[model samples]
Target: MVRRWQPPWRRWSVRNRLMAMTAIPLAYLFFTFLWYAYHSRLSEVREELAERGPLVAKVLADSSEFSVIARRHDDLKPTINGLLRTDPSIHRIDVLDAQRRELVAAAARAPGGTAELRYYEAPILKRLMWVAMLGPDGKPYQKDRPAASGVTVETIGYVRVTMSPSALLLKQTRRFYVELLVGSLGLLACVLLAWQLAKGLDASLQASMQALREADAEKRRLIGKVNTAVEDERKSIALEIHDELNATLIAVRLEGQRIADLSPEGEVRDKAQSIIKLALGLYNSGRSLVRRLRPEVLDMLGLEGAVEELVRHYDSARSGCRFDLQARGDFSRLEGDIAISAYRIVQEALSNIVKHARATQASLSLALEQGELRIRIADNGRGFDAALASAGIGLVGMRERVYALNGSIALETSPEAGTLISIAMPIR
Candidate 1:
């Protein structure tokens, strides 16, 4: 026979399976949460960089406009360096003239090679204004004319700021680690709870199985008691018939014979002869009934002789089936219940063969070995479908008897293959 393969989880215990089932989903959820949190935090970091980079560039442009117009580049270095020192995220700052020449530059030390940089720019503007309305006498010239004034804005320089996100990324990474730790702890707790639940279920199942076994044992014990009681009743009935009915029939036969001998060749003698014949038939029937109820040969010759006598009787009946018995080992000291159960099992098997098998040959084998009695009954009959056929009373009785004695029985049969019954019973 080839064994089929099963999945690895199929072989796991209930507790393990339950824990795995619980943990897998929790782990998935944890990973999903981490993924969402990482992306969300990254977006926040980007937004902060966008807002802070532009504002710092604009402020530097406004502050450096006057210095750039006066061509005092050296004075602007201190402010640019101070801005870089205050914010570690600002990687570099540059001030350029109208021709895009770097007039002053300040840079902070780069934290890592992989740091991402963002750039923001703002233009430095100079406002020029023209003044009119100056009369020759410096006095107000009241004329019905609107005053004309003009102002012009000109780009003088530009401020460019470079920013890095290494600090924000580090902070996000630390937060993720903390969340992962908490999620792992929660998943482990769920797995432990699942294990505990599985343990409880397994314990309950074991208790139920134990109860069932005890019930089955009690049932077998009750069956053995019933069988013993029935056998005792049968023996009592058989004794009554043997001692009372058969004796009465024998006496009636003797009286009829004497009456026939005294009355010579008359109607009375013919009637007496008929009476004697009827009495003899009744006596023979009673004796046959006694043998069936309780075979006396079992007490005299033990189980082997009783079974042999049974087989011989069946064989002599000429029921179109040949019966054979093969015996081994001594059965003299066999236990009463075991012997009787074994004999009854064989008897039932043979009866079934004769009444239903339509077999040409049947064999019974008995062996006593290692303090156990083994019996096998086989017949070359047109066997029925054992799976489909409802078990007959004879088979049920045989099975109950064997089970009551803590023995085992197996029946093998199929269409056109014949039937075989194997049984084993302890001697003690």
Candidate 2:
């Protein structure tokens, strides 16, 4: 099977993902606000410059009319200098006569080559009034009858003001920078808050996981105790059957034999012989049951010997199938629980092979290395689907026994293929 690729963010922990979700949108909004603010501030500064420039020129032009008419341009310099001193936006002021001749000019210090300059012009107007008066002949001269009062307005000179927008822009830039800094700080604060939240959630998740692990461990320990208790009870029953029941069977057989020998050749003698044979068969059956409940070879010869004996029994019983056993390392130092569980696991596997595998050949391998016991059982058989068979009593019992000892087991099998069962148990 091929695994599909996942985005890098998918691998992030819940905490990190949450932080990213919160921060990304906030960052975008913050930058968008800054962009709008920058443009809006720039437009406001430009508008202010436009309004201030034209107004300043009109005022200067009105003031300079008399100075330009009298040709006493020097008189206007003081007013021009005063206006320049009062307002920083005004870069230069010029007074020009009607003929476009420079009369007097006053310019503020150059702001720098990079300063943006704008020009505004306002025409200085002169008003003249013509009144009809008696001529030297003592009569009003009537060129065309004297019109109603004659007043005429004429442009005398111009006032041109040069305005620099650098000051306004600089002020706006400072404000913009401050706003940006504040926004950046706010974003940083949000990220920090997210990090703290994530940390808390992660801690809680870890605590939950730890509790679950402790509970599982406790469950396994309980299972181990139960298995041990069951085994102990089985041993007790086996001992009772071996010492008490077998002894009674032996006594019955001996009495039957005695009756047969003493009785003369008749139906009674034949009945006694039949009784003796029946007793012997019952005794043998009882022995086999005792062995099944608790194998004596396990205690006498340890795990390896017990397993070997079991294999031999199965091999002899099923002539059509062959059984093999391979062992490594010492089995004598194994703990009782580990030894018993391992033996049961192997027993269950072999039983499954015989009952369901329809196997012609099977092999069991055991190894003890680095404080761990490893066992493998394989068979050349018509295997069944492991998933379907997992719920079977035999496999479930094997799995529970292995889990009770905190061991691991893996099963590999498919239809028409051999089944392989592998287990690893920590002996220490």
Best lDDT among the predictions, by candidate number: 2
RMSD of each: 15.8, 16.6
TM-score per prediction, in order, is: 0.56, 0.55
Model 1 residue runs over 4 Å out of place are: 1-198
Model 2, residue 248: distance off in Å is 0.6
Which ten contiguous residues of candidate 1 have the minimum total lDDT?
A: 139-148
Candidate 2 lDDT trough over 10 residues, lowest sum: 107-116
Candidate 2: residue pairs that collide: none
Candidate 2: stretches off by over 4 Å: 1-204
Q: Residues 90-195, candidate 1: write the lDDT tens digits.
A: 8889888888898888888664344489989999999899856855567655677545568999999899998888777788789878887887788778777877
Candidate 2 local Cα displacement, residue 11, angstroms: 12
- What tens digits encode model 2's per-residue C-alpha lDDT throughout 1-428? 24679999998886888788888899899989999999999899789989998898898888877777788878888888888888887888888888878888888875534456888999999989987566667788687756346889999989999888777787899999999999999988998988898888888887887999999999899989999999999999999999999999899999999999999999999999999999899899989988888988999999999999999989998546799999999999999889988988888898888888889999999999767899999999998887787679888888888888888899899999999998989998
